[model samples]
Target: MTTTREAPEPVTDVELVVLLDEGGSPIGTAPKADVHTDATPFHLAFSCHLLDDEGRMLVTRRALGKRAWPGVWTNACCGHPAPGEHMETAVQRRVRQELGVDITALELALPDFEYRAVDASGIVEHERCPVYIARVDGELRPDPDETVEWQWVEPERLLAGVRATPWAFSPWLVLQAEQLPLLAGAA
Candidate 1:
């Protein structure tokens, strides 16, 4: 009588805390030895909600060419810090990378606030986002690669746009709107 061999266990990269990249399959698991190796987690991120002196939020529409949530509307600026990079540096880098502008001053509102995306949108920002209201004092040039369009829209109109067209925003964006004082003040 012939017997079939048992399958071996899967493997995962301790550094990434994720399954090993096996071309395109998600069949890897953490090895028993490395499972408790205690690598630093990989969910931390940062974002800046820049505001002008007029109180208008600096909003931008994601480039249509994006793979996830393309053409969606979002806050002033958002990005993830590179490994070993500081929060301030990362925020500044992202602003330039996405909006082609620089932020002189930043205000940190929530340093430990985190919200997870509800889909496979390639976006998983577990951020300590430093929400800032920086006055605009420069040019505007939306990077075609990161942003398709950008403008300082009134908070009232922005919420109206969201209500009228909920499909134009990511789930997290909508959730953040709940905390905006624009709605109550406008009403």
Candidate 2:
């Protein structure tokens, strides 16, 4: 008699975000889908800037169906980390899920980046978001639900564009460019 074993089903965990107090301490966890509102509480999040081998930065336009900042151009990716998940792990997960690409040389560029912005629709985004920079080496396969379009652009050109028309980009990206030395030369 021969016996065969079948692979077990994968577990699908409900996505929860780590909420933060005014002092930037973890207060609790909240369901991701229900957290954003006009009075969204401060939460932990991360942003990534992806670069190609030729040194062009990868930027993406948010999907029109996104709840906040839809159809707006922004960084390579941004996402909230799962409760108890490591920062780098969350970044990698979101990059793959949203852009369908792999990254290397992942480094934390801004360890204390935080922002609070209100979307045109009045949805508030208050996040203690750290910034990361990474390199990609493959063709992008962006998900339509997370990204509507993408482009590889020179850092200087992106900085100039953001500075020239701040209203054309996401608030966080505009604010980040002001502080990042990588774009400082363009100023």
TM-score of each: 0.65, 0.92
Q: Count clashing residue pairs in model 2.
A: 0
Q: What value does the lDDT take at residue 180 in candidate 2?
A: 78
Model 1: lDDT of residue 142: 64
Off by over 4 Å in 2: 1-12
For model 2, how does the per-residue alpha-carbon lDDT over 80-124 read when each residue is reduced to its tens digit?
Answer: 999889999999999999999989999998899999999999999
lDDT digits (tens) for residues 105-126 of candidate 1: 6666555455645334544433
Per-model tally of clashing residue pairs: 0, 0
Model 1 TM-score (2 dp): 0.65
Instruction: Please list the residue runs of candidate 1 whose C-alpha ends up more than 4 Å from where it truly belongs after superposition.
Output: 1-42, 119-130, 180-187
Cα misplacement distance, residue 3 of candidate 1 (Å) = 59
Clashing pairs in 1: none
- TM-score winner: 2
